[model samples]
Target: MCLQSDLVDADVDPAVIEATRSALHQQLEDAELIHQPDEAHLQTAKERSEQLNFAISSLRRQLDAQTRDVVAPRFDAIADTSPRVASLKASIDAITQLRESWARVHTINADIRSLKSERRRINKDIKEKSEQLKARQSLLGDLSTEFGRLLTSWNLPWVDTAVIDRDTFLPAVNGQPFESLQASGGGITTSVNLACSLTLLKFGLDHADVLVPSLLVIDSPRKAFGNNDSDRQRASEIYSRFRTLADAYGERLQLIIADNDPPPVTSDSFGKVEFDYDNPMVPGVSHPGPDHVSRLEETADE
Candidate 1:
């Protein structure tokens, strides 16, 4: 029932208003997360790996120089003591290579340890965040249940996705978290997918709450897409699924997405409204509001 460019008034339904507020708050939360990416856990692992590499390189260089210094002084002595010199040279070379190789192996082992530590930390952080999300989602669920109870008293379909602790059920692979829907599938990639789906579902559930705002806006959800065509396509598909989820809410949530590039079009579900880049609301742009017009004219005469 809303137009694309319409400024939503403050008189919207409580559920719609709460949805809008949650969506906007969630967007801000996500933005803050991007600005402060949780690299602390990864940094320890990365630094350990780097230090190990540096130590290995430094030891190898030292060993190589020492070997050369040892061999260089024995060049003339080689004729008289050729067999000894040759044997010594072989021993030095073998030991140097072995030591260097061992150093590298040690570094690799250290790297594995660092990675395991990082993974543990990452999992802990993810678990904590998942718990927080569940906490918020539980509040939504209570609201949904209350709404359903009210509807039941009047006899109507619940229409809210009753999802709780769905994220905890997802299987994590490597550092990436994902859910295992199939016998052969489950990884970080899958966890991210599950997260996105849960986000979409949460968006809907929040919309059904009578205390939420009616607006759901995303600045650019696909900004993470790199130059890879397949990745871009995948991003588009994820976005499509998001829109589909929004539509499934069926008048419960009103979505508004703004981006520099046009989002992939679907059949009759979403529409675009382009604003002039010169507009003040679009950022780095000037606006000639009514109050500015006469002031500028008066200044010109002066």
Candidate 2:
């Protein structure tokens, strides 16, 4: 009976020890779940603490740079200075309008240069045109001489000779001013006009550089405008002179004389193309005759 009781006591002691160990293990697990940090959380908190320390160190270094040991009292003098005269001790991030304004100034200067160049070009053109005009007008003296010779040949009355006035480019009779020819009626006037026309013709034929074509067309020189029966001899003389020119220049000069009842001048140098009421310029058209005008005048007088 004593041995059985001792074995039972040994078994009870082992059960109490096991209960105490289980209770201590359960307390330790509860404390760990409530307050102890995990491995990943501890690593993240360490990295955050290191970043904060580095930021503090950087701030302290920046503060040291602004301390009295580095910055001098001379910087305080800028406080009383004007904005225009003040200078900065430290570089600052900035943008200003001066660079853009300078660019605009350059653009305006380029435009001015271009305008000056164009003005020079225009001045050159004006000078060249003026020179060309002066050159073309250099033959005025020779033209005046030819005009006087033609007036003498055509028998201008009451004048020893006539000259072309430089200012008006018209005839000046016997050293008279413009329009000073003492002539009445159409007789002397017609002679003067014929002489002027022939003078121009001769001048143009002589001067190839002049702006005159090598062509002339004289239409109806006898019927109405100044060529009467009294001036028939003079008109015939002019036609003979034309015949002489047509023979001299040949094909180089083209002289077309269209007179229905032509003056008494005939030559192989002048080709004849006659047109009457039958064979007209157009097939079914004809001009009203000079007699038609005279008849109308008679009716008006009535």
Candidate 3:
């Protein structure tokens, strides 16, 4: 019992100890069984443990080799290339700045090309407009010459030569505007108006582009002139000039005159329409007495 108690204290079940002792005693009686391990089996176990240790050592060596293979080249590459990387970064930065500068240059070149094209267009337009102005000025020169010739032919009292101003396109007698003749008298004004009208009629007939009709209407050339011998003589000369102009233009021009009395001309070149007290130009109006009728018609008919 004390031994069993001791066995229990040693954490060995007494029943299991007894069973193991009985099995060992039975094994000791067998001829093939020994109390200690066999040398051959111990040697085999030692060989197996040595093989396992060798395999573990080989695996550790392989792991170290793999680590070196994976990590050493990366560390070497990092140590060798720091300067090259910095140089490549600087080159990249330089290329970036050059590209930015080139882009700016390209933009400026494009703007310059656009402005040059616009300048060419403006020059073309200016040339075309200038040509048009030149043509208009030439036409005006021709008209001025024609107008001056008619004024000279009419024998203006004070005017030696007449010309149309290029800038104003108005008649200038002796390098002065025709309006200056208005200060002289109504006789001069009437003469200038008649000459200008005849000149304009001639110009209209000659130029296809002129808008004026080839017709003239004069109310009274001698209305401003008083009843005197000098006025009558001037009126006769004006009528003679009219006859000459009418004969020159012939059927191309139509001249109509409405006057109180006819000029002292015996030429059969012009037709006359006489309106008397008995036969008036307008109806529903009493004519003046037969004594007041114009005797210029009798002279014209004769």
Candidate 4:
């Protein structure tokens, strides 16, 4: 029922609309339509709340005394004697932490034992390998000495010194590579290769341990000779050396020689086979014309 002008003329802190709200409140207060709580009821509620608190305290005291007198001693005795009584959250957490630590220690101990066993096995293998290496080195040293002696005995005119490399086991002549002495054509190559083969054969024959063929085959000792008298003599000397080796080794060594022409051999201890255009090394081969008959006859006479 407030007039619009009255609403406009009202002075308020929050808003001008509060003028109606204040007037309605004053009318309600004057008419006693708004409630006013009784202090007597509030005082009765406070007294009841205090009585409930005291009653609860007395009950809690009785419970604590009963637990301390009866159940506490039994719990303590069980805790002291039986580990299973520790069912608390803190005890379980502590035990779990200790178990994790002990498991880690056990894992580390197992790894250490494995590593120690591996170390011992590795040490034993290394020791055996070292001994084998020493024995091999000694064998190579003897082989080198034997190779040097053979170069001199084989009529190697160009070579002053010869040796077998211990590491690679290749032949070296005059403190250099094998090719350095073979500039005299395939003859030198032939002799050096021949000497190496024979030396290994002799080594195998002498030592029952050095595994090599007791039998050897020579294609041609004088096949590369260029009409030089010294080359012929060298070839003859090679045959002589072969004879001596055969005599010395006896039944332990076998030598098979094949050649179109070889210098005169002083020894006749070996079997001989003659082959020409008529009879070749391989079967079912055609022969040459009659013009080669004289040459083949001359070779047979030689």
Q: What lDDT does the true structure give each of the candidates?
A: 0.59, 0.71, 0.79, 0.78
Please, what are the lDDT tens digits per residue for candidate 4 over residues 1-302?
56545544345456545787899889998666433354566677899889999999999999998889789899888778575554566688988999999999899999999999999999999999989888878887888888888778756667788888776687888776755646655876787788888889988888887899999999877887656788777777778878988888788888998877743785666767777765765555555657756676888899
Residue-level lDDT for 144 in candidate 3: 77
Error of 1 at 268 (Å): 1.3
Q: Pairs clashing in candidate 2? A: none
Estimate the overall C-alpha local distance difference test score of candidate 4: 0.78
Which ranges of candidate 4 are over 4 A from the true structure?
A: 1-95, 178-185, 226-229, 281-302
Q: What is the lDDT of candidate 1?
A: 0.59
**Clashes (candidate 2):** 0
Per-residue lDDT over 4-120 for candidate 2, one digit per residue giving the tens place of the 0 to 100 score: 545555457777789999999999998787556675688889998999999999988888787756455445544445453533312121224555777898999999999999999
Residue runs of model 3 more than 4 Å from their true location after superposition: 1-132, 178-185, 226-230, 266-268, 282-302
Considering summed lDDT, which 10 consecutive residues are worst modelled in model 3?
30-39
Candidate 3: give the clashing pairs: none
Q: Write the per-residue lDDT of candidate 3 for residues 12-77, one digit (tens) a residue.
A: 678988999999878777635552447668888999999999999999999989989888888888
Clashing pairs in 4: none
The TM-score-based order of candidates, best leading, equals: 4, 3, 2, 1
Off by over 4 Å in 1: 1-214, 278-302
Q: How many steric overlaps does candidate 4 have?
A: 0
